[model samples]
Target: MGSASLWARTRGPSQKAHTAEITSGGIWTVAPQLEQERAVTGGGYSTPVGVTRAEPEVNVPHPQVDAVARRAQERVADAIEQLKDYLAIPAISCEAEHADDVRCLATKVRDDLSAMGLQHARVLELDDALPIVAADWLGAGRDKPTVLIYGHLDLQPVAGEEWSTPPHEATVVGQRLYARGSADDMGGWVSHMVSLGAWLAETGTLPCNVRLVIEGEEEIGSPNLERFMDAYPEAFEADAMVLTDCENPSDAVPGLTVSLRGLLEVELHVRALSSDVHSGLWGGMVPDVSTSLILLLARLLDDDGRLAVGRVEVDEARRAAGADVPLTPEIIREGAHLLEGVEPLPLRGTSAAEWMWWQPAISVVATTLPTPAIKKNALRQEASATLSVRLAPDQTAEEMMAVLRSVLLTDPPGGVQVELRADGWAGEGWLYTPKGPAFEAADRAYVRAWGRPLVQVGVGGSIPFVALFGRRFGDLPLILNGVMDPLTTAHGPNESMHLGIFGKAVLANVYLLDELGALGRDGIRS
Candidate 1:
């Protein structure tokens, strides 16, 4: 499907007109036709920010940014093409068979980075882990800040997902480039690559020292990122870091990620009988494990389908920040691809940002419950469901598990052998408070590039690598930004990155380098 399908208009009490733009903080206005033309052209270029935006929201233009922006614009097509080359490999990290593909992509990136005049561009290997690609250029000298850029090359598994376009072919429909890794990551770092490439090509050097670290297994929750970090500490040394795996609030408004929810998976197993029992014969006499399982799961949720137990109260400051996020029901409906007549769970006096980014949520990801293929009028011996929990920011696995166990283990419907076990991957959440000259530098850079200062935002999903970065280098400024919008559909089928976002992101990176470099190491360090 194309933009026509992705942005299909819906008229109802829950959704607004599809043609709307969120220009002000937390406010939306009906968009004119001119706003639609502020998108990508066939050549993968964007309408100049000056022309599309009518007037600048923040004008902090610098002499260096002007030249860098031009060079970056000239190479937007190359960046798009480079992203396609990388996305085609299908370097899925979760499957055993695709291990070689991950290695191949890592090597290709290493060589390509080497070609960009970076020093020591090579693939890093660990005994039992996938590879990571690294390179750096520090010739800008010690006085300038060293900026480390992070992104992942691995992709979510697409074997069972339906796609409108070929998942790996990198198709461009409407204004987006549709591919598995287009926005989630490849586009993120590729924009940096193009920015760095332009700096090297136009002036023969970057404004600041730069290091590139591309992980090969992020989609698998970055299980070995800490191991890679431990084994190669020097590769991570930087005065500041630009974590490129994040989202913009809107394609029109850039977002600086300030928080991320954690992930924890738990499995619930119910067993009442050793063998299958005919449901009709034992309908009322026996306590069916399947029915018991359904009831227990229901107990964990509220009428709106949110996790009822262990909900956290938000402070006024955070609650106000959440209110400033333009997460109207229309945006949520379009972004989530909800079917007609199906509405998002009621907000229930909470802002979407607060509910999604700060509070806890749960979903049943997998279960041993029978399907039609195994249909029989009988109760199976046991049933299990693997629940994926999105924990509150700053919450730990142990804390959420304790709360879950307290509710799930007490008062069984049939007194069946109920077992609640922590299962699958688990990671802690991160909450950061950005302050310093570095954030000021970032705001200047974004203002020049996007005509507006960066808006603070939080992600609902867990990024293990991000928490690792926060834990390891909390003292340094961590500027998280990327080329994703609500419609990116990352980790899901039909994933795409808006080409306009890609183009603007490259310029933002260009300005970011100049602004950070001007701050000098000493100024940034404090």
Candidate 2:
């Protein structure tokens, strides 16, 4: 029987990619307000280095930005300390046991935002889900544009992962803070806090109206984020948004994520008999389901072991853009933690960025095949393997499934029964081209802080919230940035955030608000 079905689990990290979202340029969503708590206050990239250009420059540093930037620089150590406090909480959202930790972190953050003098800081609670922290400072007035800063308070679980230091204890080793959520999200938003706090301390008000929507379930793919958006839409409304949960191409090069691969998990199964049979009696007579399962899976890959189905053709412009990302095998080896001798697969004709961020890929995440502990001298009755597919940006789960079914369900070895099911996760990929003045505003801020403009980059990993944001607010400016570099190792052991990146992100944020503020409410979306 060649049947295709889906056994999707919409939430949880163990069964899905429980990661947060994207942006280097930025995104904006204008939604109707919903019921929410009140304690008000709030407010909230960039270029390459100083290559003098002939074009008239629009992103000059704001006069007040210098004061804020200086203050942020002074607060770097304190900022890292704050990050340490957040990392101490084991707020892994995927595990049920850690749900309280998630709420505890949200409560702590709500209290901190209130203490920071934001007008309204409160923890938003939804039934059957963890709490979300929402706050804002609207003192900048109605004319100034409101910039929403988004980040997650939850973390990826560190169980079974080896670490150089205690995973929950923030350890500074050579200017990098090692801890889960340090860079993946905590550092990304804390850097903003340092800048916003400095702005408040120096001027008593933000350069623009600002809103904070720190999520509690981002590490679990933000499964209920939409429900939160619908029930508390006020929490997400803004003239422009700065999504701070992406990665930098390098510590030296600030990346504005412009594209991302989506995620889809499918289980491929094969059965030759109702129950196990003695290998001595049936090895030659019956088809080995385990062997057949392996053979069928092989059909999904080219010699490179990459997913061969549902491939998309990239235009020259996209290829040229991917070429700009500074991804090398050495960087991948170091970032991905490949052993000394194990090398990255050959790039073949495509650039690493294209192969990673723009193409489909596959990994065998789980299998029901025999293990050493359960080895037996019998022909297995059935075998199954769960495949995690990274879909190309703009590719949908339905499109990928169609291609998979065509390749895997055609001819069966020994005509063994076969079935395919989407195990969990069918999150869409994101592809955005930043436009309007908000983007120019971002480039100016990045140039001032990083000494270079933001390099548009793409994320090979999937972030469901990003695609959701892209769909809900694709028309406006949404700047996606983060404090992560290749070496941060988010969702892995010894995750660290480069302090230098943290400092630069703080400075850039300081200038970004100033730049966006100058645009005015009408000017930003215009």
Candidate 3:
């Protein structure tokens, strides 16, 4: 039954590959239809519906773990209410106008932590940046491994017109709770909090010591996190870190994001004249800044829709790693929730999964120009745009920036003045082999909670702090786990959390903490 469901989910009616053939480069080149079958029954692949090529060798199930998970499940209503209260704060960290709101949200988090029995909870202020909430429960003693729990208190701005319900007002429709930050991290935060609260209520002690660091600026590329980490390194010290800020591939599947693409945001400005000129007077004589900027931006992507500038070529090993866990086109299409009649980018010989997770891509995110609402007959003197580049795991920000500069600035159209500036933040991508006691515990916990093996996946989005945490904590095992599903629509209209999965996620975290505590009891260090 599981195999049939896996195949059905992966194989659509139209996509059919020619044959199942392996190339000399170790990349699997199969027709789309055949690829779907291979993905379902092939070795090394696991699906959400308990379908697997190999039996998952998990740790012995903790006897009391089920009871703890059930307790967490029983508190779903309390968790939802707490998450609703959290989502009520319009903590838009990217906008400076919401500075006080963000601070207030941080304060609430600190107070909640204190209420949850962490007596040392306090707000840490760093220079002019927003405050961060930090607290620790060290009651489990030094023999147990200390685990750091990281989450964000900030959120993306909501588009009022696009939302069906008020963005700050949590409303339940079916099993989903509609609100801003309901899924893209406030839900995750509440999940951890509820799990901890349940454990404290039932046992009065955690299996491992816990340290919590909830930041207020994760949405803005975590601009102040590195400085905060540098100043207070000891506060974040732990054997393992659980970053509850990533999304699962689908609602049913539990995922561990093993890799994340880095980000480099650039602003390109072009000037052909000193000031706006009348188009009627200089229509033929003067070069249009908008035209020049468009041409310059067009050079960034080739006909294949791949990055022409700063392209990072994936080697054989990387290709093998990506291909080992292939994402079928059907899965990609469903996960993306693409608009009707829209298709994925036309990158030949590359699957949708590879293009998204393993390959580097560039996008023109925003353009600063005169809008149609404010139309003018005069030719603008300058045209500017914001470009975002998603770098692969093997690529470095410095090297890619140099390549981009070389391509964008080498030759100017009509000798127009072109200036490309690095827009303040550049985060390096992170990739780590999933191993160690923490990973094993996570595998067992996920299986126990979800009734399936955990799927290892890669996210194209950049979480700047994940890489920073690795650098600060000296390569501790970091688990990128969360409750958001593909339909959560985080950072978009009608953002929500699937309340059913949200409850399951709390249970999973409960099991995870229990499993980690077991490792501590055995004195096994990752």
Candidate 4:
């Protein structure tokens, strides 16, 4: 399909040329040709600290970088073969039984890094936790900035029956590669490795110092990341970071993620009696735990699907940031892959994109009760459910959890006892504004590789480690880009990665590193 057709199919109808200007809150407004040139030359981009320079511009034209990247693109077949070997390992970190597989993948990654000529490549062993691979190349002097690349080596579990091809075996159909981790993350890891390998093969040294932190526990909400960070603070220090685990809005246009929603997992349990009681014997006299839990859950949302626990207000800055992003019902339908009979929720006084990316939302992830197959007619002794809440940028997990706890405990259903407990893996939301030299360099790199302006967007999902990195690095520019497109079907059946986009992403990273190196040479701080 043509790029325009694919974009329309994936992101709804196209908007006017002026609409793009409104989406960014007026931070970027220029003619098409001038905008592309400014993005390439860093002419009109602003820095947060207001530091300006008139030094000689380091210009590596698109053709020069593309030539080097084309050499790497020539090896796409080899890269795919190696990726198949990597994907063959069932590195599901959520299940304890797959711990060995996770370690195997970590060792493989470390070996690959070593083969790439990195000076230091080893796995950091955490006590009772999956191993994390940490590698660095300090060939570039301290005068140059060090760039950290972050990705995950683990993946979600797979069901064999649900997939058209074997999830663990990389199967290529047309231009797409089908595998468990092909798009969600292994594609990201491979992209980094390919770029670095290409640079090292073409030239003996990299443009800047590099460090990699590939973790094995990210699929499980990164439960051990905090412990890892606390234990070794100096290992992760870098001047800038590029997290290679996000999805593009469409196949034609690359997206740079600017924000991620925070996550809070909660479990609510209620008990009315010590044991299951006969409903017919005491149907009128005894309290129903199921009914009580149902009533409590009903209070969680009002008629409009807004959370009723407390007022959900959007941040002024975030609202402006998402103002002109076109998110029609058709767009949501295509993006979400809604079933034929499934209808979307009513408009909640905001665009669907704004509601999804900038506002708070709740979903009852799972519920536990007696199965109808067992034919149980007794009143259940206890009822429980799992609630997952996605918090906006300005909201913290603790504050939202407090509001939910207050509402649940306000009034009891006569005799039923209620208990609410957090799942111990709360993650704060993260917001980043594109400014300074690093962001501009990334924008130029994206345009150079894709021939289009990069889309600054927000992700409704949460990556716990991104927020952790922000806290640890504190204002260091974070470039969030990835290879997966809208139709990659990450974390779902028949997950695949488009080879065309994957090759382009590798080329884009090559350009990104070159651009950042030029800025470092010019004495840019970030």
> How do the predictions measure up, each by TM-score?
0.88, 0.89, 0.83, 0.83
lDDT tens readout by residue for model 4, 103-209: 99899889989997886798888898998899988788877788989999899999544999999989988778999999889898788888888878777778888
**Models sorted by lDDT, best on top:** 1, 2, 3, 4
What's the residue-level lDDT of 39 in candidate 1?
27
> Which candidate, 3 or 4, would have the higher lDDT against the true structure?
3
**Candidate 2 structure quality by residue, lDDT tens digits, 323-417:** 76778888999999899899888777888888888889988998998899987999999999989999999888999999998888998888999
All candidates' lDDT scores?
0.81, 0.80, 0.75, 0.74
- lDDT for residue 387 in candidate 4, whole number 0-100: 90
Q: What value of lDDT does candidate 1 attain over all alpha carbons? A: 0.81
Q: Give the TM-score of candidate 3.
A: 0.83
- Point to the candidate with the largest TM-score: 2
Candidate 2 ranges beyond 4 A from true positions? 1-56, 59-61
Local error of candidate 3 at residue 194 (angstroms): 1.7
**Model 4 CA lDDT for position 189:** 73
